[model samples]
Target: CEQVTIIIIIINPGFVLVHFDISPASTDDPDIKQMMAGSTLRKVKSHSWKKHRHFRLLEDGLTIWYKSRWAGRGHSTFSVSDLETVRDGHQSELLLSLSEEFPSDQCFTLVFHGRRGTLDLVADTPEEAKCWVDGLRKLIHKSQTMDCKERLDQWVRDWFTKADKNKDGQMTFKEAKTLLKMMNVEMNEENALHLFTVCNLSLCVLEQHTSASLMSPLLSRDEVWKVFQDFSADGERLLVDELENFLQIEQGEREGRAQELIELYEPSEAARQQMCMSLEGFQLYLCSPHGSIFNPDHEQLHQDMKLPLSHYFISSSHNTYLTGDQLRGQSSTEAYIQALKRGCRCVELDCWDGPDGEPIVYHGHTLTSKILFRDVISTLKEYAFKTSVFPVILSLENHCGLEQQTVMAQHLKKILGEILQTSLINGQVPEQLPSPQDLRGKMLLKGKKLGGLEQRSDETITDEVSDDEDGEMERESVEDLTKDTADSNKQSKLSRELSDLVLYCKSVPFHGFEPARASGKCYEMSSFSESKVKKLTKDGKGSEMVQYNVKQLTRVYPSGMRTDSSNYNPQEMWANGCQLVALNFQTAGLEMDLNDGLFRQNGGCGFVLKPEFMRKTDSEFSPERPESRPGYRPLRLSIQVLSGQQFPKVNQKEGSIVDPLVRVELYGVPKDQSRDETSYINNNGFNPAWNETLNFVVHVPDLALVRFVVEDYDKASRNDFIGQFTLPFTSLQPGYRHVHLLSKDGTPIPHASVFVNVSISELT
Candidate 1:
């Protein structure tokens, strides 16, 4: 015998209100809100392929979904948060290629953050294109301005939307269990039910009837509620007093700031009037920028910029023309634009004579494609101060003859115009190199000069000059030229007009530290190969090198043997207080990651002030032995890996989950360089918890960079990289925090983070 039974569960109305309180992003622009209806545009992959695709902004206003008409069910989506900016008209290569066929007004480009490829789109009319461009810009601004809590709420809402397969706005126990698994939790049925029941009991009343209905089950929301209850005297709501206690005790916030937070985060008018916060309001407060892991005080221009140029480490790039290997690669102005956009204040240009008396920039004697020097100059003039207003150093390896060099000088003076620093700043030779603030919006050429600063502009003196000091030679041709110049003192004719433009950064031969200091010529700088610098540092000259860099500048570049455009670790050069440690900026790896991390502070102005000890001309600080330095204090850093959220899968195969592990690395002085990793969490990439602690003793916290790396654990072979984030140790905010992870190309991974507890204390 079988008896038919039906169970009905009713959810509390309060719970429903709280669950749906996650509102869509609001905008004053009606055109942006109308984007939810979508439009059909031509997606341009190249000049040949332009497919009609329907594009729509989701109701959340954060994501955009697009699909071709032929693809009935297949679609692609990207979040507005992933975009860097939007370019109207033919700003991209693909769009420019289509300019002959399509009007510039009908074209636009979507530039994504990091290394993500740009999306070129063509609208039916200029009005349609403007609609999309303006709407997307407004949405991107909203995404950027969202508070931390709102971002987390959006993140949770996105997960709920994905978990709700039937779109019923309610989740059953079965669906809840599936959601847990999808979130990378391997919990038993009993535990899952217990958690679900506890969350329901706290928020609503469940009644038995014919049908069962419950509010969506989000584990993060439950956790927030639990945290809220801990601070609430009566688990129903948090009063002003309770909220203040939580802020001061847990978040290290100052006293009397709770009321400000309540007014800012509380969504309900009644709650605001009563000075009380509901669960939703409490959750919002917890996700706000005040609760973020990164210290908000450091997000703006906080560092001093009045110091001399040699007192800071400048962000620089080598072979800025080549986007690939040194031998065979495409040299385009786009490479310069990308580097400049990334805050590279120093860019290298290898000039060779081209047809029609024009000079071209490329790797000399190599098969790399060439870009006209005039075009490059135009690009530099346009983008030099886009990302940063600091002075730009154009490191020119001039291999062109007199006529072509004169043409190069003409283009520089014509295109760059007033931005070019032709002579001294105050009509007097500077005792020290001018500060970045003093040289703001100025471009300085770094190349060979004909005569001394006091010499007349028309005076030209030929000298044996080898621009290969940084090992710019790639093939036998450059090597033979360098050999001939060295062996027979062969002299290359200098263009007097071009030579007059060289002022601050005159490339001079380096003999020894004693002679350089004796000359006291702060304007004269030298470039050394990475190998040469490494040898000098290792040969017991590290302290001397540090002192020498206090007034003069030193630029270190990669060895010529790196034909593949690989980069040496810039930290090694920076450790000696070398200002311009140029690296292959196109390569995405640990080297570039470290470079980006160091320059990510002080509003990413491309110059970071060196440590005090390294800046003092009379002080002695060596990277090899940091303990002996004055005011040396070793500190203990403890990081507790609590859990991960929405880790992107490294393997794209269906149903493939990752066993993720974390590695915490400390890069600085030799004594402080160490790494510690946590054990892998098997078969889970989302919401995996390790609860493991990694410790390090940092001897030079000011100079140290802490990197957090997440990788997919494979026991049979090498672990695959997932994502990583690196920041200076001084920038770390100690408390329970979330480390937002970045992709290999240094772009933020949407909704991906590792929650941890960080503590720093003086070593006993």
Candidate 2:
């Protein structure tokens, strides 16, 4: 059976039909090309759970199919684009655990994007592992470099392969109609036949006019022509007037830009001469950066990075070492790498004393696993600036003894070297904190400092203050270093080496707003639990909290009671002008969605400059009274939930189609927060059209975040999440736009999107 299967794969005519020459000839490496031949490898889920599986790369060069012998002919597949990277050798803990059984050179791991689990594999030979690793790297690069149009084309091709159940090159009219329904198009028979006839005629004309060699690839051009015909009145040519209408109505471009676009994107000289666009030109324009839903102007480092760090909302993570719940989670250096890669500027590390005089990081007195503090520091040094060049803040929750603390400090200094910010910039402490631009590529320690910078190095200072001053320790089951009793006031000796490393982000206890205002220490920051911050905000001290945050930085963290490692809504903290509002990065939900949305702007540099009103100390801009704030203006936001395309199946059971619905949510000032959803479209996940208009009156557009959520409607149970996309209202581009949907973990879902028309106008 195995020999027959190999022969079939080698000589199959269907392989040629499925293969697309998307990768350039120059990039066709021998190793990658060899991946078309299948191999057998051991898939390792754990030390005791390893089984042989047949693995093969498809002819498309973008997908991998794998199946176990026990599964018979059934197989599972994943796209190369889904992978974040390929790690050679025993880089992952799972691969490293099998070191005794498998040589390091024979193992590799495929790390996927978002929250997907890593795939660990052990090949029969070292050369086989290298072939897989190097081939995957080249394929990943090709996937990442594809433009918008290329990705869409690949997505369409993938769907076609799935629809071709017979594995034949041709599809009957009945098969084409079924494919349309599976793609979420609910057209009547008459209209569907008419459209299918038009497409068939378009392909026939292309095959007749072009050479035999070009006929095989004409299907892609036919798809583009179909889209062109939808917008063009003549169905053969797109004039400048029609192009202008598309730009204005579909692309949300202002009037009179059609001629410029034609000059810029038109590939044919005839189309350029006529001041119009062809089918190819239209596809090029759609693939351009300007055609994206995100404003292209904000795609780079467009924001002012010279502002003080406190004047910006920083992306942050709490319990950065944990991959799961705080109590029993596994702590690994990979957590730090993941956080930094996602542009988390501030990461919390709970350091406790470990064996061999090394400090370990984990939730203290819990079942959670521990990782060496030095390893976390080394990981940070490598990945801190990989995604963003902005400075990173190590929010250390130090509970280590003096001996291990010194070791921790030594490891940080030695491993990080020049990356650590051990002294004031320019050898002077300024009245205001330095900007992210000034501290680029630097890492600051956010923990207790022994004393003032003038204090003698030999002097011993008692670190008596607790950053978690709200008695969070008493709420959780985990034991705290300082229990809630007379012993709660007990102090630990500070290590001079560690204390000196805390320069810019010296951790201090918050007494009151008056004391913070009087001290005026821009470098001294405080950490407050979510409960305490909520109390302060609700007690009419919201204005003072904002004013205090404008000078001295304030960090808000979740309550210790949330042992599940859940997150508080960071927006509430942001509303109060909090700088470092940390949340559990390991958790995925609405809070994390909001966090990703807010930081998805300003080039995702981990810092977004606060609005002018939030930064001004005397502006009296309380989130509780947004209407009375300076420069306050109410805006009417209208969004027409038009349609969705290629929505993935929420339930993968056979013939299980989703009843999809679209929900538009507004998150901001309390009164401005609301949600409106369209009625569900029955048995249609592919191309559901709502065309329902939802209007919102945003009182604070600068702080408001608009979230579009699609769910599979269920009458008997809660709706299951399908996909969503969220962005700040300020970043939203008006006019007709396609909102590319993301999985729950915030990774892009290929070709899954919602088309909507947006308009925002000031409300009188």
Candidate 3:
């Protein structure tokens, strides 16, 4: 028999109660009295105005109150739906004043911001502070993951309250226009009337839908009344009590859990006493800046500093000087600035000799524009560690003469100052790459090394052409061609000072694994073209690359054919444990999306610890030889499509609804796979019940990402993307869950979700 555990949580003003059971508990008697006792539950304490208070974090909201018979006995509550941020006292000096009042070592401050003003409170102990912060963060995450219809209901109520300018339950046409402007929605009078008519108030529309009925311009349509009723309990105007119930359902509370929620998510005394939730109030709440999806006080949940540098994949940008394609592209240092700000740990700079004796960065053989190397260095100095304090790798491709190379070195050292890493951190090379934490805020220059000045070509011989007059010019040109070919055989190295800076990350050509290891310079790294590495992986040399990457860094770049700044699927490179998979960051597509998804797991810090098998020195795992594995299991994923809520319109006509279909994509080892819905629902945006089941089998589930994409079907053209949600296969929990839809830019869309029930099984 399989045993399942479920925990039910109740929140009252200033109190949180948790109850666990092996089976579902009856909600008929909510047991508010039992919850109020705070028995068999952990409690977090805070101080408001120097008075002791108890805080409860519920799924939908937060409550703080004093458990007393005195004047401050009543608790205060606010919905997390309108929460904008929860910041620590250290973030704001104003809040720190309260924290300073207690023993500095023992106390911390917390400030919760919602649509309403900030709630400033002090925790008595550091432990209490951490607990409140953690609890509130989890609740905020829970709120973000609520059912789409439920969240949309709260959103509708919130907007309605805001648009009702006169505190009356109805919004006038003038008020509706203002609300539209506030939402940044541009609609002409006709479009506005069309929307209002959809609410079934066309009875009030004139022939051109321009003129409104004279009496107050209030929408008194039955359809509008029905909407209010849907949000209210008694099929009438929403009261505070009814609003509470509406929120509880959206918060995933059980049917009879209303009373417990009422106490927990308390309204203001005036609103409670007034009882009515004016349409104006709903708009006020919905339009207000609720908390951001990101919590300012969220501690680093991923271990950023735990592993050696080689044990992670770094967010990297290729051809950092150019903003566009390799040919005829505009080169600017802004690309470097943008990449650094986007949490890229590695940036490449291709340096060539420029006019006026300055080194410039650009595509060496292309028609791309150029920026001075000094300018690139300045930009790097300003933004290198702004988004993340992790070490930055300056993958320098040197094509400059010795003089300009010296100038490049001077600019780097002068502008970057102490932040530049000129020597090994511990005065010696490490057996393993150092952790990003140990080299924080440091920039390491990676480029070719130059031999001593003795290796310089005889400068006089170039000017002294053959004495034969007629053949002198032609002979010089022929000799120049010969010299160029010979130059390819030797290293076009940097100045001695610059060469010293490339100590750890010296770029070397890759002949083969045995040659690289035998070179006796273990710090020398190689940047492999994507095709070269792919050939190695395909030719059964991936295991060797994996072992090599465990000790040294290897950068894999896009194939030369990708002149449009396109990207190859990076998972194939990552399968070899390649650390630097440099991509054109300016490009936006599925490749960029996958890159973002992978790095997002580790706090978006541009480094994600590799899997244990990849990081191990003695692992026998092989990407090309999966059949040699004895312990591998073939995994099956069964996902049941239940329904969609408030689907966003994609490529349909302005007033036409969507024909929604879902496509599931599995991206990882053993070739990326996908399955799309058999059929799409017609003319529906509210709710489309598919009740369909999709199945997938995978050999490497550990490295997989399951992306659920919703799209609109069109007979005349390609389907339009609605939104998508992606999570690692390992992170997937087998149960009924909501797939929250996100825009292409990764922002969550309100009231958009596909309800799904997932089950995973291992097949023999």
Clashes of each: 4, 1, 12
Q: Please give the range of 10 consecutive residues that has the lowest summed lDDT in model 2.
A: 1-10
Sliding window of 10 residues with minimal summed lDDT for model 1:
1-10
Q: Cα RMSD to native, each candidate?
A: 6.2, 5.6, 18.4
TM-score winner, 1 or 3: 1
User: Once model 1 is optimally superposed onto the true structure by TM-score, how far is the C-alpha of residue 343 displaced, in angstroms?
Assistant: 2.2
Q: lDDT of each prediction vs. the true structure?
A: 0.79, 0.78, 0.60
Task: Give the true-structure RMSD of model 2.
Answer: 5.6
User: How good is model 1 by TM-score?
Assistant: 0.85
As for lDDT, the candidate ahead, 2 or 3, is 2
- lDDT value, residue 40 of candidate 1: 95
Backbone clashes in model 1: 4
Model 2: clashing residue pairs?
184-687
lDDT of 3 by residue, 1-764 (tens): 11112121223222222121121112122332222222211222333434545554321132232343353645555555445446554333234434455533433334332112245555656655555555555556656665422343345444444555665445556666555544324456766554544434222322211122221123222322333467876653466557656555432334653344333332344544555654434422322221111111221436647677888889988887776787778886656766775679999887889999998888766678888898788778877877788889998866677899789888988999999987676776565666888788898877665431123332212121221111001111122333454444343433766776665575655667776555435455777777768777776777888888887788877765676878888878887889999888877667776776676555668877787777777766677765555567768888887677667666433345677888888887654356657478876655677878898887777677777888888999999888877766765655445676777755567757776667778865
What are the TM-scores, per candidate, against the unseen true structure? 0.85, 0.87, 0.60
Candidate 1 ranges beyond 4 A from true positions:
1-42, 45-75, 160-182, 187-218, 221-288, 463-490
Clashing pairs in 1: 8-209, 148-287, 149-287, 149-288
Q: Output the TM-score of candidate 2.
A: 0.87
